[model samples]
Target: MASIDLAIAGLAIGAIAALSGIGLLVTYRTNGVLNLAQGGIATLIAYVYREMAVVWGLPVWLSAVLALAVLSPGIGVLLERLVFRPLARRRASAAESLVASLGVMVLTLGMCAGIWGLGAQTDTPAVFPNKSVGIGGHHVGVDTISTLIVILVACVSLGLLQSRTKFGRQMRAVVDDRQLAELSSVPADRVAAAGWAFGTTLAGFTGILLAPRVSLSPYSLSLVVLETFAVVVAARLVSLPAAVFAGLAIGILQSELTQFTVNGSLADIYRTLGSNLFVVVLLVLLLAIPNLRELGDAGSAGSFSSRGGQEDTGTVAERSKDLVWRVAGFVMLLAPMLFAPSDLRHAFMVPALALIFLSIVIVTGYSGQVSLGVAGYAGLGALFSLKLASGGMVGIPHLPGLLAILVGAILVAPIGLVTGYPAIRRRGLTLALVTFAVGAVVSRFVFEQPSLAGNLTVNPLYIGGWELGDKSFYVIELLGLGLGMLAVRNLHRGRLGRALLAVRDNTGGAAAVGVDVRNLKLLAFTMSSVVAGLGGALLAYSASSFSSDTFQPIQSLLWFTAVVVFGADSAVGAIVGAAFIVAIDVMAPSGSSTLAVGILALALGWLPGGLASAVRGVIRYVAEQLADQFVAPASPIRGISALAPAALPAGPGAVAPSSVGTKPAVASARASGSTAGVAAADRVAADRGLALTPFGRTLLGLVGGGGTARPTPAPARANGAGPGAAGDIDRHATVGAGDFGSRNHVEGGHR
Candidate 1:
């Protein structure tokens, strides 16, 4: 009976999760775009509702209706028109759409943080009264009953709409293939817009209902809603009924778990597990499920690559220019060493962060693998390094900071192999969710474990019993960065680079061609994880402290976004992105850097290849224009004087005097470089049995020599002849034969 009551108590959360899962499933099914920003939209709507009801003194029903009905759906329509429509029109890849949705998520969170100041608000108003009633020995809250009723009605209505309505059929058509649907006379755009509007309304409802159950904050509610993604994942993003059922089952199961009270150290673990059951379920489902059949095209991760202009071998001038830019970049990277101690301390994060960003570049850019769990690897690195240095880890002796960092990175490499093995089969959003789940699991279980990470310490790098000061350490970091860059350069060149590129461009094709796709992917993952581990260790040592929060799952998303925004494939861009992020955060208020990155990412559709590629394009265009200005145009053929008539072959094709010497007076009057002179020279050359170049033939035709027919001599001009009439007749027949031969030759050559 108590368990039944607990399940009833859990029904409110279950209903909210149902709404969230349904919203996600609907958006994905209708628009063929998984709405990662659903949580963001929910958070935004929840905040607006709270402000309207509590701060602005609006009626509860009015606030709920205005926020859910007006603001939520309006935002959806606006996003469809502005962000998604452009991507759809361009036929952007699914990975691109995924990134855009992430941008939206970050932007919304940033906005909420900026407006609400990151503080928790507990004064959220509930739409349904918090009154309860007894039902057969179990007490149930009115709000809980109302939520269940609402979810049932919503689900039934949606099922009927999808099964019975023409608009729903049109939506299904659009989802199957937007272009085909349009060709079949269905309004795909309108259908997509309607889908988004309805989906976002459900998101709004989820947020409004859940906000009163928990503290209203920018991150808390959003994260809570994000955890509900488990429901959607379990449903495979297809079945609405499955999603609803999963939500309720998980919610009730979580509540039931709370009833158990274990003894000893396991108690805390058990409690944490019960509390975070959704996260655990998400992780387990991602790993346990062999495959998820997504709707529409299951796009590859290659869309993240830069779509720059045509590839060209660098000219000496371009090479020199690139060298100058590289030098300037190095100068910028090293300049921080000369700054004040405080500023230098802040700058220390640059190399470490850049290294971390470069790991993302290696995996996502070079291998086309979508890894969202880099933060997990980094956290593991930090934890392992700390444990090794303090002699807390089993079978490992206390070591100096440098050795610990190295060993920690080396040890983490195998973990990458373990994680990357899953990626051999998974791709796109499935792979993305799997990686994110790994990061979340690590954050919750490993990083948050008091026994493991609570007493961790990070010591600065040391060599030969001599401690390196901040400046010296910074120099070492620069050296480490240089080594990382060198390794990346090696990866980007030669045979190995080509192989990786082949796999990235087309995995199945690479496999068909006998390339070991599995091994190459694992190798990329291993190397990237090592790089991330090294960076994590350096990050810990730079601050001379360790905190799990430093390597949170959200930080992974930011790092990925920053790398992409600055040019995912560009090492220099990674360095610049790190500096840019650090500078923005330092110069502006908190969360400003996130806002900046979010804005740039949102504009990724318009600015393909990101900031670095855009800059390169502009520079290349300018340089080409300048080069064109200095190039001279071709000179025209001068005159027949350049083609001696005496050089004509003395054969059956001997020069005819009538044709060669009767150059029209009008032709001589024209300038040497004129079109007429060029044509006359070509005709004279051809008459002398010389082969005509294509350009010369074209010139002769343009000036009416080869293409135009000559007027026939008057038949027997009154006395059966004029002066040089026989020569004129012979010349005309010879010239006609030469023109025919030349035209045939040109035509044959072209073919």
Candidate 2:
């Protein structure tokens, strides 16, 4: 009977969870995006409501109406028009959409942190009074009753809207085939905009109701909203009824579990499980479920890092710029060392963060796994290293710093493989959800567990039988980073690299071609975990302590978004992203880096393959200009008698050199030091050939020698000055260097 009271008390939480899930389902069904930003949207609106109602002293009802009726939905429309519309028009894959969603999430968190500050606000205005009334000898809160009504009304309204309306059919059509719907004049964009509006409206409602229940803070409130994802995942991301039922049942069960009492670690584990049942269920459901009714291609995991049909090896011009990029990146990395002692201490985090970012590069970039759990592995690395160094683990002796880190990283490799087994048959958003679930589970079950992570401490690490200073430790960090880079390079090169690429590009084709797809995926996961573990260990060492909050589940989203914005596949991008994060955090306000990353990620539509690819394109253009400075044009020139008849373009479009009224006698004068003959050829060129067509001008720009002059015919050369003479043009050997940024390898080889 007491359990009934607790279950009733839990109704308020269940109702809001239901709304969150239903909102996610509506957006995904209509727009084919998982709306990873749903939680952030909710958090942002919550802050807005608090500001309007509490801070500004507006009436609660007015604040709620303005927030839900206007501001929240406006954000949805703005996001649709600004961030997502271009991607949808271009038919961006789920992986790309997922990154954009993360961008929104990061942007909203940044906005909240920037404005409200991160302190917990217990003064969130509640729409309903805090008092409860008796119902048949049981107490029920006004908030719970109001939420129950809202959930029921919201669900029934949505069901009718999605079924009994023309807009509903349009939504389904757009989701089924947006381009085809547009061809049929179905107003797909409008339908998508409507879907986003409706979804975000529900998100706002949930946030308004939820703010009073939880402490209003940027990260905590958003994380609470994310935890509700179990509702939709349990619904198989399709059925609204299933989501509602699952939400209520989980909520009640969690509430009911409080009655049970036991002792020992098993009892402690059970209690923790009850509190985090949503995360546990999410992980189980993701693993147990065979397949979801996802909208994108099954092998679309590599789509975010897609090279946009560009070749992997690229033009010779592109290759030439690599050395320059490499040098600049090296300088960027080393600049931190010359900083003042305090600044250098802060910069220790740069290399450590780079290693973690590199792990993401290996897993998501090289293999297209779309892992959002590298933070989980990284956290494990930190814990394992600390445990090893402190001799906290059973039957294990304390080791030196470097050795413990290595062993801890080695131990974490198998764990990554074990966790990644689910990825053996998953990709794209489905795989992303699976990895995120695994991460959430690990965070709750391991890192947050008091027995494992409580009051942990270790001595300063010694290197080579001596304790090192700050600068020396930084050098050690650099060495570790170099080793990690070498490993990434090896993974991205040779037969193994090609095989991983094959798996990423097309798993079925790779299997057809006899590539062991499963083994390669497992290898990628193992290697990625190793790198993350190393980085996580270094991260702990830098702080001289292990802290669970540092590796929160939300950190994974931030790191993944940053890596993709900087170029997921390039190791150099990881270093730059690390530098950017550390630098931005150091120089500016706390959340400024997050805001910048969010802006850059949202702009990923124009900057395909992220900043790294954009930079490479620019360098390739400059390289082409340099090549043009030296190499002669590859195409034939007319109106020059030094050129043989065979050298002229033979097509009908070709104009006869004789039409320009130029004579053959100009050949000798043009080929030698005679100024008069050169003038005659220049006159003809100025009248006709000097004014190049667009294609010819572009070719000349890329390969610059002898604009209108051609190599003298063998007989004509014999009659003129020797090859060493002043007017003699040495034949340009670089014939095919005209096309700048030309792709040289197979198109779209997993980027």
Candidate 3:
């Protein structure tokens, strides 16, 4: 009977989970967005509701109507119209849309934090009071019954609407082929808008109901909602009923598990699992699921517009010369080491965190794949190192840090491969959800498990015969980062680099060329995860401890956005990105880094390929300008021959003298020199062709060789100079040296 009561009590939580899952599925189905913002939105609305009812003195029902019915849905519709519509129209990659969703999540969280502060709100208004009714020796709370009823209603109504209504058919058509549906005249936008509104309303309702059961703090509530993602994944982002069932089973199972008695370590493990079983389930489901319905053509192509379309006009040799610039950027990273001792100590986080973000760059940037589960890999890396060092398992005693890192990397590689399998067929919002679900699972089950992670201790990496201090450890980090950059460079060059680029650009096209897309994708994921694990090991040592909060799933989201904004494919960019995040946190307020990242990520459309790409462009442009100036012809000789001796040498030699020719001869000698000067002037004019406008060319003719003189046909035609014999001589004298003279003349010298 007591067991039955606990099960009943669990059902209430299950019902709420089911409601959240159902809401997520609806949004994915109708609008094809997984709504990673769901949790953030829910938390935000809950706070709003609490403020309206508890502080603003609004009636409970009125507050609920305003929040759930008006404000929440209104927010969703506004986002769809303003933010998502433009993205959809431009056909943004799924990874980009996922970033946009993260942006929304960050924005909402910041807004909540700004409004209500980070403190917990325990006095949240509950829809149903603490009252119970007894049925067949089992007492159930009214809220529990109401929650179950609400879940049933939502499920049935959604199922009916999707399967039966005209609107449902149109939605299905649009989801199937948006362009085709538009040809069929279905109002896809209106249908999508309706879906967003409906999904958001459900989120608001779920938040209000769940708030009373859990403390209402922005992070905690949001995380709780995230944990329920297991329910959504179990449904494959499709069926409401399936999600509802998964939620209920997880809730009831968790409650039932509490009654079991066990030994201390095992008991702690069980308790943790009991509370977070859904997260474990979610992770397993995400990794195990074969395929998911993708949103549009997202995740199928590389996110960069300049990827293939832009010629590598910048050659590998040319690009390598830019390595000096990258070294300069790296030097900037080390600048902090020169700061005050206290600040220098904090700067150690830059390299360690940069290594972690480089993992993101390798997997997402280089491969054109999206990974939001990096934190999971990092946490696992930390966990493995701790466990190996402490010798927790049988027959395995404490190990050295270097050995622990190798083992940790090896362990994480398989996990990456496992996750990569799902990624091959899933993309965009589907992949984002899947990866996020995996992170949540690792966080709840592995990180939170006392038996696994609670008592684990991390040891420092050792080299031959020396213990590392903070500065020495930083040096080690630098070496690791150097190796990481080498690996990334290798990945981005040669056959492997081309193959990854091929896969990223066009999977089908790449496979057609026998590129083995699947193997390459798996290889990238494995390598990336191993690097991430090493970074995680470093991060643990830097902190000198392992805490669950250090590897929260939200951190993964933040890391992903940072890498994307910094330039996904650039290792140097990854380092700069890490430094930027660390510097912001050190210099500004705590949450300001996220705020800055959010704003920059929102500007992704304008800054294409992120800030790294923009910086590369600026550098490239400057380099080109410098190259042009270095190779450009020396300035045209002007106003120099005017001060020269008359009848200058025709071609660097004295003119011949003749008697009949002497009189007419010196006349022709002078004429020949003028023609020579005019021809030189023409050559100079053509050399400056790039700078000349049609108007400038006309002006050049008006400033003809010399004033008030004309050259006759003999020498003038021979030199390809027209009928301005005297004018040509005057122009030559007006300019330095003859127009056709050698370029090595003085600024105003005719010699």
Candidate 4:
């Protein structure tokens, strides 16, 4: 009877989790994007439901229907059209789409916080009666009964929708190949829209159902919903039944664990297990699942994108741009020191945050690994620093803050190396989930547990028996920042940098070309963690106390979004992003930076490579424009100097007359279909300012487009010209509709 009561207790919650899991799986299966924003969407829809039903006094059923059928799906359709459609059209990688979804997550959370003031709501309205009913001489909550029925209906309905509908077939086509489906006139956009609509409607329903059971806050409710990611992961992001079963099993297991108890630290640990069973299950499943059957792994680079910078020609431009960025960043770092102690104290977060951002740059930007658990490493670093400074760890003496930070950061490197093992095999979304699980587990089992991270105080810094002032300590921070920059630069420059870039671009190709992909990835993770730990240590020391809230799993997501939106590939960009965050906290409203980051991230489709690449391109374009104003332009016929010493023009984009034939000679040349015709055409081409340089001719010859430069054979004489007929190509080609004649004759004729 007690076990039956526990199962009944868990039933409603489990059903809610299944609902969210189903939405996540369906979105991934149909849209080819795992909606990282599902939690955000869930949280938002939950709030909307509470607002209408509880606050506005609307009927619960009416609110539920409006939220689930209208508002939630409307939000999804809008996002699909605005945020995701462009990405799909351009064939964005799963990694890029995940980042875009992060943008959405960040944006949605920001909206909730801005509107709801970040407080928890306990008065959420429930659609079903909370009272239990007697069934077969056993008690079962009406809500549980209703929810179980809803889950059954959802699963069977979704199964039929996918297997027994025209839209479902279209959705499958879009998921398999969006471009191919579009080419086949399948209306990929509409199919995608429908998929998102269904997914978000389910999300809305789940949010509404779960709201009454949990304290509803932007972060709390979102984390609760995201915890159900374990259910989907257990399904390997595919199976419907697996998600349902796993969600129910874990829920019941958690409820049943409450029946058993122990005393002391073990009791606390046991209680935590019961409370966060879902989070722990997520971590376990992610690590133990052998491999995720990623839907679009074939084209996924598993790295943040900067594809918009395709025009970046490596030259002095990069050097010049980097120098300018350094100068500007240095100014921003120094300005904080001039503020009042209170304000300057707040600025303490800047350099440390930059270090954390750089760690992301190293992993995601440099090595092309999706590392979402850096917050956990950062938290561990802070915890380690405290223990080292206070002599909390056995066999170690208390140390100064600086030494503790160094030792703690270095200590985290091995942990990173171990975590790096998964990255060696996984990429993109799989690696992302694994890393996020690591962070969540650490946050729950370590930071949130009093037995692990209680009574942590900021360690003091001293030098030569003297306590450093605010500005001096800031100088030390600057030094550390400089060192991090130097280390990152070393990793991104020369042979090693080339190898990393090679591996980032194409792992198999890099291995084929003899790059040590394994060692390099491990090194990246190791160095990245060290930097993150150092940042975390510094971050803790700068604050009043070491607080777990500072490194919450949600903060990791925000930091990643910030880093990515600013520029994942630029050290200066890391500094810029950190400064932006610190500045927002100091000057703006709460969560403003998050809103800004979300907006920018959602625009990654256009920004490409984040804000950093766009800035570099603008800088280079201006530099080139200025240079062009001062310097002599290059000559098209300049190659003739090397071959024949022919005189050339003084400016670029110019055609030199020395190599071109005169008009009388061009007219004298016969337009025949033999080698003579080829020579005659070449002369005519030069007269028309299409002169082929010696080098161009040679290069063209290699590609079967030699000096002859003949067009492909026109389909049996384009526009119905006779075989062997040759129009006056040069004269008519320079004309209008008449020119179409020469285009046809010359394309069809050999010449």
Query: What lDDT score belongs to each candidate, Candidate 1 first?
Result: 0.75, 0.76, 0.71, 0.76
What TM-score does model 3 achieve against the real structure?
Answer: 0.76
TM-score of every candidate relative to the true structure: 0.82, 0.84, 0.76, 0.83
Tens digits of per-residue lDDT, candidate 4, 96-188, equal 788899999999998888788778899998888778899877888888888788788878987898899987788888888889998999998
Backbone clashes in model 4, listed as residue pairs = 306-609, 633-652, 634-652
Kindly list the per-residue Cα lDDT of model 2 for residues 1-751, writing each as its tens digit.
5988989866767877888898899888888888889888998999999999988999999999999999988998998899889999987767778889999999998888878777888998997888898999899888888877877887898789779998878888999999999999999888989889988998888888889888998888887888898899889888999999999888888888888887988776788888788888788888888667788544355554434423243334334645655776698778878989999988999899999999999998888898988889999998988888888878889877788988988889989989879889877777888888888888888898889887778578786678888899899999999999999988876557756765665566556545688888999999999999999989988888788877888889899999999888878789989989988988988778878888898888777678877877777677679779987765434333323333333343443322222344544455464788676654544332232211111111111211111222222221254433322221211121121223221111000
Q: What is the lDDT of residue 557 in candidate 1?
A: 77
Candidate that beats the other on TM-score, 2 or 3, i.e. the better one: 2
Q: Give each model's clash number.
A: 0, 0, 23, 3
lDDT of 3 by residue, 1-751 (tens): 4788779978988988898888888877877777878888998999999999999999888898899879988988987886676676666656566777777777677677667877889998787878999899778999989888888887788778878899989989877776688789999888888888888888888889989889998777888888888887787767777888899999998888888878866776677777777777776776677666565656543664222122121355336545754886679667865777688778878877988998988888777778888999999887887788777646667777777766876689899898788777765665776777778778877898776677776666677857777777777778777877888887877557756765665566555535677888898888898889888887887888998888988889888888888877777778988888888888866567777887777677556678766776777678778878887755534333432434333443333211011233333544466777544433343332211211111111111211111112122121333443221332221121223433333221123
TM-score of 4: 0.83
The regions of model 3 sitting more than 4 angstroms off are 1-3, 53-62, 113-120, 155-166, 180-186, 262-265, 304-328, 386-411, 414-431, 456-469, 605-608, 616-751
How much does candidate 1 score in TM-score?
Answer: 0.82
Off by over 4 Å in 2: 306-318, 634-751
Q: At residue 730, what lDDT does model 2 achieve?
A: 19
